[model samples]
Target chain A: MSKTLISARGLRKSYGKRNSKFEALRGVTLNIHEGESVAIIGKSGSGKSTLMHLLALLDKPTRGEITLNGHPTARLRAHKLNTIRNKKFGFVFQSFFMNANDTVLNNVILPLKIAGVGYRERHRRAVSALKTVDLDDKRNNKASDLSGGQKQRVCIARAIVNDPKVIFADEPTGNLDSATGEKIINLLFKLNREKGITLIIVTHDQDLANKCERQINIKDGRIVSDTSADAEQDDDGDEEIREIIAESEEDDDEDATPDKFEGDNNIDGMLDQKHPVHHINIDEDEEDL
Target chain B: MKFLDIIRDANANLLRNKLRSFLTILAIFIGSFSIISTSAIQAGVNNFIDQQVDSYGGEGYLAVVSKDSFDALEGLTGAMGNGNSTPIEYKEDKIQDGMTPITNEQLDKIKKIDGIDGDSLVEQKSLNISYVSSKKTDKKYLIGAEALPPGNIKVETTTSGQLDLQGDEYQIQLEKKYVDVLGYTEENIIGEKIQLVVVDQFKHTQKTFNVKVVGVIAPGVISMGYSYVNNKTADDIYTENTKYYPAEYKDHVVAIAVNYDYKNHSAKEIKDKLEDIGLSAMTIDDIIGSIKTFFDVILTVFKIFGFIALLAAAIGIINTLFMSVQERTREIGLDKALGMSSARVFLSFSIEAISLGFWGSVFGITVSMILGNIANNIFHAEGGFLESFPSFNLATYTIKDIIIVTVLIMFISFLAGTLPARRAASKNPIDALRYE
Candidate 1:
């Protein structure tokens, strides 16, 4: 099985202090493996964004710990955290945050600039990233002058410019029309499949959640349902079998329906076996049943 | 972020709101202009005074007088313009007319003092010359001439050679005005002889002494338009004028010019020693120090105004930067979220302030220099106030003052920037992103 890129256990997050304190996340336990496209599905205020923030190392958890590549991130200094965020992770926000007055190429160059890349090399990398998004022609155009879809594409270019290992997208298509959103979704999955980059997307859209290999539904800061646990018993035995299935699935690439449900099934099964506590937490939160 | 990137971004940010930045820089320019202009003017005045001091017998030379005579001179000047002031009472011990002579005992003590160059001592005797004439013109002109002091004395001259202090030949450095009146141009008069007639007071008999013209003196406030003569010529002329007086009165010296070891002892130290011997001494600074003090007072007042303007400019920097911080809240949040450190954000803002100061001071210095040069040219031209003093510059810019002003203004800008920079650094990325 692929190595776990990020693992969290009993993570909790809160805001304010004492009487006015509020809990954003009670406890979330999950493991995201390398190259897996996982969707964290939830409504607003469900703490899915908070979980993503902790998993991406953009913030510190109030309780418990998160380990990136088996190193406990809680003990790392702020500077180290910033370096990790800059080098190892990418982010695509829903609002498409950008320096609007700057050129599109400059917006994409932000992450590489922060990493202290040389000017010529960073420019080269930014142009290549923009090419990947098919927006290289707009390199010199002001970011504000672009359409909403183009702006999101430019934001995606900025996200991947530093060659990050993981891309945490906070509602990547939240502001787009369905037609443009589908194109963005296709591009994200294409990068995941081609470059082997792990994708952790936080979204409420059911259609988008179903497109990923695994869907973890968060309700009131607790994971209520995770589809990966149902096939836990077949994890070790199914790796070789799943590879055969994956090979055959690649043959019928145009048939999107069957591939969506069955793709990477064994990979999800491996998750529940290693982390029994995550399964137990889901069982305990199933009081509605 | 790299430091260069932070600085570039800072300058770029300033351009985003060009009008506001320009106005802030304008305020800073006002303060810098006034300050640097004053410093330049002060430097120019000091340069002119230093030249004057060098011409008047230099740093080591002092004019020594008996303490009583010095005090009586001060009293006489003080008693003027006030009719109510009492007249001096007669005293048997003190000289009645305030012209007390330096006794032979005091003269002996003066020569014995440490650091005093005994050979450099020359009594400042006023020679009563009847009139001066040159062979080119029969016209006799009234002229005042004194013996040149000892040591490295460089009298400002239009055209001249050094005066030989011990030369037996009588040498005179005639003033520019007398050069024309005696029918000799400055260039052609060198090596020529002029006649100085000294008439005895009692006998009314005259002895004409021929003195060679060595140099032409440039007009200066310190020289007072008086020509300088060599020691031999001055001694002969004094002897001829006072030949009939009592032999004891011949040595009644009121003042003497002397040189001392200026490198080993300060002028004040030597003055103190002279004071102990019942004598008073005035250094070159003591004589012309009032001019410097007057300029210093006026310059200091202008400098105070400059600082006050700077204080106001500092407040303007704070206000401008604060508004910038507020306007760029979301942009700052984006940078912070993208992993730009709090310190870097603070640095970027601080750099913006420094850039403002840098531009302001650069503009101030450039404009002031241009204006100063123009003023110098205008004043040095014909019919200008400074026309007579060709060697005097109205303004002088030194590299040290330029650096000092730039550094000081930038430092003040950084101090002013701290308030807004702290605000920017302390902003929470999440909250800042949420800001509209």
Candidate 2:
């Protein structure tokens, strides 16, 4: 097996106070090897996003430890974490959160700029990253003026500008149609294959998950099935597990309608519990079927 | 992130909301304009006053009088207006009516003072002139004239020549207004003789003495419209005016002008030594200190108003930045997620505030300078208040004051920015990213 780049043990995350506490992740322990394309699949509120956040070190777990490159990350200072994230990881979100008023080149320069790269060198790297995504010609154009696909391509350029060891993508193509989504997926996979950059994607799309080399399915904060573990079994067993994942997704969709109202209230309560003044709440309800 | 990148992004973000940023800058501009303008005016006034001080016998010059005489003069002026002191009790030993003369004993002691230049002492005598007349005009005008004080004194003049204090010939530095009335231009008046008629009050007789015009004196507050004459002219005129009086009365000296070592000894030290001999001394500052105090009070009030305006501007900075922080929540999240440190996030916002201050103060200094020059020109034009005083500028700009104001305003802006910057820096990345 390839060397493990990241490993987690008994990861748990909970939101709010003791009485109204919601455990997003109960106990998720996993290991991701170098250069692997992995997809974490789950419906809304299944804690797939929370698990991804912990593994990416974007957040700390309530009762767990995460190790990156065999070194414990729990005791690291905020400055070290920021430096690690800046130099080693890149992220892509569904909304392509870019400075809309800025040019595409500046948008792609964000990561390199954060890493404090020299002006000319960062510019050259950003341009080269843009070339990788085949959007070099549109670099000077305003980010807001671009189409959704082009904007996502620019976001991808930003992600790879620092030459990160791992790229964490959260619903990278959720806002794009299938044709545009396929192109984005291909680009991400191409980076994974050619540059040997690890890809960790969090999504509810089964087709997108199936395309990845490994798939981890989460349900109610627990790992239900992992395709890598099933790979040791027969081919028929792998097919059966895939069928089970699809049926469970269908069951979640059926169960979602009634739980939608309660889930929204829970989000509101969670927002109040976390930051009453900011009103920063996750829109988990919108991600459901 | 690099500091330069933070600054660049800060300026870019400000441009994203031009109108809002402009209004905040406008508020700061008002404060800076008022402050810098007042400072310029204060500097101009100080420059003019310093020039006047130089025209008067300069740093070491002192006017010595008997303590009783100085107190009486003060009492008279105090009664006339500005009643700041209580009425003095009538003391038998103090002179109640007129000025007390500096006795020969006091004069001898004054000459003995450590820093006093004994040879520079000249008895102050009022010249009783009947009238001044030039041959070209055939018209005589009443005039007040006094001898130029001892030591190296340069009277500010419209024309070139200086009075020869020790000249054997009667030399006079005529006032500017007298030059035109005497039918001579400032240039043509040089080396020409003018008649100074001194009249005897008892005998009712007049003696006309011809004094050469050396220079035309510039109009100034300290000169008080008095023409300057050499010692020969003043002594002859005084002798003629008091021809019928007793010898003792002729020698009675009310005041004396003297110079001291100002660099080695302060004016107060000399004054204290003179006071020990029952005499009072007034330095140039004591003579003109009231005018300075008046200007200082007015300028201080104006500065206070400027600070109030700056306080309001600081609030405006806080308000503008808070709104900006709220608007750029998602962008800040993306920056933080991209690994921009919390301190850098705070710095970016602080830089935005500083940029606002920079632009505001720069605009303020530029516009105020333009307007100050325009005002100076207007005040110095014909029929304007400052037209008569050509040496006085109504506004002055110094590089030190400009730099100080810019740094001060920028610091206030940074302080005002801290509130919003801290809010931006402390924002949790996940929550901010999820904030739709």
Interface RMSD of 2: 2.8
lDDT of 2 by residue, B165-233 (tens): 887999998989999898989998899999999888999998999999998899998888999999999
Q: On residues A1-289, what C-alpha lDDT tens digit does candidate 1 reach at each position?
A: 5788898877788989999998877766778888988888766676788888789776788987899999999999878887888888888888888899999999999988888888999999999999999999999999999998999999889989988899988888777887788778778888888888899998776567666778776655665456664322212333455445535544433222222344455433533232211111112211110
- Candidate 2's C-alpha runs over 4 A off are A229-289, B55-57, B84-97, B246-248
How many clashes show up per model? 0, 0
Predicted chain A of candidate 1: TM-score: 0.80
TM-scores for chain B, in order?
0.94, 0.95
Cα deviation at B408, candidate 1, in Å, is 1.1
Cα shift from native, residue B322, model 1 (Å): 1.3
Off by over 4 Å in 1: A230-289, B55-57, B79-89, B199-204, B244-249
lDDT of 2 at A182: 78
- Among all windows of 10 consecutive residues in model 1 chain A, the one with the lowest summed lDDT is A280-289
Docking class for model 2 is: acceptable
